[model samples]
Target: MMRSHRLFLIAMVAILATVLFRVPAKADYYGEPAELVDRATSVYKGFLADPNLEWFRNNVGSARGILIVPQMLRGGFIIGGSGGRGLLVAQDAATNKWSSPAFYSMGSVSVGFQIGADVSEIILLIMTDRGLDAMLSTDYKIGADVAIAAGPIGGSAKAQTADILAFGRSQGAYGGVSLEGAAISPLVDWNARYYGQPVQIFDILINQKWNNRQADSLRQLLPKPRRNAQPLGR
Candidate 1:
């Protein structure tokens, strides 16, 4: 009897170890910085090509910064959560040039009558300096720290004045989508690996401390700011 009990415990331990090893880590979702940049470029190009997002193209010239989450997943049986990795780039007011990309992660959770899952590609346009400043912190809640509104679609949304505008292309069967309490934070491990050193979000987007040549394609896709445009402010 003693021998049988010991054998059972060992088998359980071994099975647990195998299960742990099979599961991928958070770092796996980040991929390489170059690969992420390429994906971001593709996402942006797809937005431009979509006729429903023509308002985005028209108003992009006035944006202070843009954050692109190539893919975000949300699902639940009863309780629910959503999360994804993304990159953000700021535009220089004087030169109208985009800075190096800074990586971030966004997540939200809810408990209600919800089921199934959905995947979405989200783009956030920082329309004011206040919105950009909020993102520079270590972390913040979307609607709590800063304001965000659903971007108007098609060509009819002409005069938007929100601090931040969000647009998403979602596919899958989900009850509904809500990002009101979503938290946005810097992806520290991913950023360190991408830059090959520990760096701050401001260093990448504000100070221009490092540059990756692979991001050239993404930089080119950013819309040029209107000439002599004043910086975004209240």
Candidate 2:
């Protein structure tokens, strides 16, 4: 009887130890990193196919980089703030190869926000080196750190000098939306999640230290790299 009791206790302890020491499951692998890129890809395709975006389609090839925000929710929710997740990728100057996409938190808080709500898809063309530099840093504001002008709509619209150009489409009660004064902050954790390791903003965007095959299709959708990424009049 004593021997049997000891054996049963040992078995229970072993089972408990096994349960306590087990390796847990990995984090949600298909979370923001994969899902956001997929959405951005769809938005990019939609923008390219839109007949109203003639200027965008024609001049995008010259951009140094592009920031695509699939859907930015703006309106009266609680108060004074609105934003969405976005991904940014830059073209290497020498190789002209597109870098891995890096996630960014984009939005602005304003006392002037209207009462109605809207969802806006925005793409910002980083037309100059300064604009690209701002994107690699910790944070940058649309109108403050870089000058931004709305991309002209028609095919005949000529390119002008600006640090960045904004292209957007909005659906809701609000008439339209402007990206001016919007702040962009790097989503470093998303990069780590997507790449399977933590990396710096510069490493992801400029140094090109990280690569994820998941983002390959999205990178391929980018406009062909142009020799000159600078603005025309600048």
- What lDDT score is found at residue 138 in candidate 2? 88
Relative to the true structure, how large is the alpha-carbon lDDT of every model? 0.76, 0.75
Candidate No. with top lDDT: 1
Query: What TM-score, computed on C-alpha atoms, does each candidate reach?
Result: 0.83, 0.80
Kindly provide the TM-score of model 1 when superposed on the true structure, using C-alpha atoms. 0.83
Candidate 2: tens digits of C-alpha lDDT, residues 1-234: 999999998996775444323211111122567898998999889888887777788778778789988777665522445678889998886787888898888877767524555567888888888888888778888888677787777666777688788888876221123678888999878878889888898888888988999998998888675565555423
Candidate 1 C-alpha error for residue 165, in Å: 0.2
Task: Give one digit per residue, the lDDT tens place, for model 1 in 106-222.
Answer: 887778756566678788889888898988989888877667787877666555566788888876221113467888999888788888889888888887887877788898888
In model 2, the runs with Cα more than 4 Å from the true position are 1-31, 172-177, 226-230
Q: Candidate 1, after superposition: displacement of residue 59 in Å?
A: 1.4
